[model samples]
Target: LFRWDGVRDVHIWLWETGIDFSSVIASFNCGTNTFAKNHLFRRLRWLGHRAASHLATLGYLAIWHGYHLGYFVLFLFEFGCVVAQEQLYALIDRTPGWAEFNAKPIVRPFVWLFGRLTINYAMGSTFMTMGLLKTKYWIGVSVRSINMFTILGCNSTIKSAFYVLT
Candidate 1:
């Protein structure tokens, strides 16, 4: 729900006011948005996919944080989550009646539950990556935690894409 409209409203308010402490604080608050809008997106516009630009932006953010392997791993996992969410939304939008079905009172709760579970799972892995720091340790932990269900869940999109291609 990070809508551009809220950001636009803040930008307009800032523009209408003179430079001040509040404006400076607001600018600092919007640093990520500013960087994405002004730098990464502009430079990667020719990539023709917002996801590519997003991946690049995440990589830049990871680099900005530090040169640690954990930082790169964490950001790459975040990029994957973003792509998965985007693909899920796009798929839902493209399928006739799917959005309506999801919106049904009876179905909505289950959908919300599933989404929450997925997000929690991703967050657990992310926190582990952040805590472990080293690539080998995190990789081992992740590998040990992986299950058949998770593997299938991750590959479902790839399978669907392959099916479409064929």
Candidate 2:
């Protein structure tokens, strides 16, 4: 049921809103990119790497937003998501037979469902943090969310191990 075309619907809705959050984000991204290219990348070659550049850009956005700790937490969480996504794609590409397995018609729906659920969970957590500007509450939520992810990761690992043994 879920398809990439649904993303276009989301974009259309956002455009209809008149106040497009994406444009704001894009402006910030452009500013960060220019600064990174002119100042940061020139001074530090290591920071020119993709991950580091994303970190720097997100950090800049966090600071630009305000002095609120929640802002920093939100952007950091976003940066982590971006990094995780890149790593996941890279791993899928590098693992022998994994890419083909994931691409198989029978497996595609499950993959789409998993990806959508994960993205929705992340977005919900992020929006919750965004709404709660107070440091104490947002920190508690962030820590709890991190713990949940950790537990989920451990469960997946255990399940995989059991499958291997069986």
Candidate 3:
């Protein structure tokens, strides 16, 4: 279901609506590429670009699906997840010790599993909810788990950064 909501669709929508496809699609379609580029302010610029691109896609999706509250709520949820993941990935990249720690044979599987689950949980609401009431209620209920996982990930990342620095 989420697979059907492709970045290509978002690009087409933005094109139809007279917006610059390059700006939004750059982050939305090639996120890792943008994230990997070397520049002093890359992270800061990517964050802003990501926010705008996500919001634009969410708005288009909401309108496409009849402008329900679920779309908005799901947008908020996804935005948080993407930002958190970006920060964590950046931290893991910058801290060689943390990166090596996570890459160990005994630890890598757990990290992979957790990452898959977190991404699915972040997107599950959009696929599950239909109407405004159901969307709002479901988001309210499910967001607790999403947020918990996010907090846990962020705490671990921050701690790893601190440990590596010290």
Candidate 4:
């Protein structure tokens, strides 16, 4: 899926929280902003929705594209990348230090550029390559870049700070 899918999801969650459930899902009112403002529960629900939809879409692609194992692999890696990105977003949003770091005149540009390059490199395989073999090859080539972004999600300092705030 495109990056806009994530933006659309945030909008949907915000919209759903504000409106009535009757105007949405069976009984799951995802838009209850106050109920889950900046909480793990909210993030979990978003991940659930994201995974469910991606699973369905991947299944459709597998069927439509001749049932390649690569489709599943791509979806799996893509899911991890998306989750990592979400965690980073949450970390940056909640961490005052990160906000300060992001605002630095010299540091800001470097971080932004590095972050974008790492993300693009991580996602390149999923977006450009097809079939299990080709996807695997591209991912192997780009794994280093992907690891850097993933490391941000796993770093103890980042997690401790992020969790403490929440």
Winning candidate number (lDDT)? 1
Q: Report clash pairs, candidate 1.
A: none
Error (Å) of candidate 1 at residue 116 is 0.7
Off by over 4 Å in 2: 1-46, 154-166
The runs of at least 3 residues in candidate 4 whose Cα sits more than 4 Å from the true structure, single-residue gaps closed, are 1-50, 127-166
- Assess candidate 2 and give its TM-score to the true structure: 0.63
lDDT tens readout by residue for model 3, 42-81: 4335546545555555555556556667656655544454
Across 113-156, the per-residue lDDT of candidate 2 in tens digits comes to 67656766665666677678877766776677777877777344
RMSD in Å for all candidates:
10.4, 10.2, 11.0, 12.0
What is candidate 4's CA lDDT for residue 142?
Answer: 47
Per-residue lDDT tens digits for candidate 4, residues 1-166, read 6455434324454333322212222222334323333443334555456445444444554455555556665555544544555566788889878878777898866775666565455555555445345555656644664466557664443344334333
**Cα lDDT for residue 132, candidate 3:** 41
lDDT of 2: 0.60
Ordered by lDDT, highest first, the candidates read: 1, 2, 3, 4
Clashing pairs in 2: none
lDDT at position 87, candidate 2: 54
| Alpha carbon lDDT at 110, candidate 4 | 78
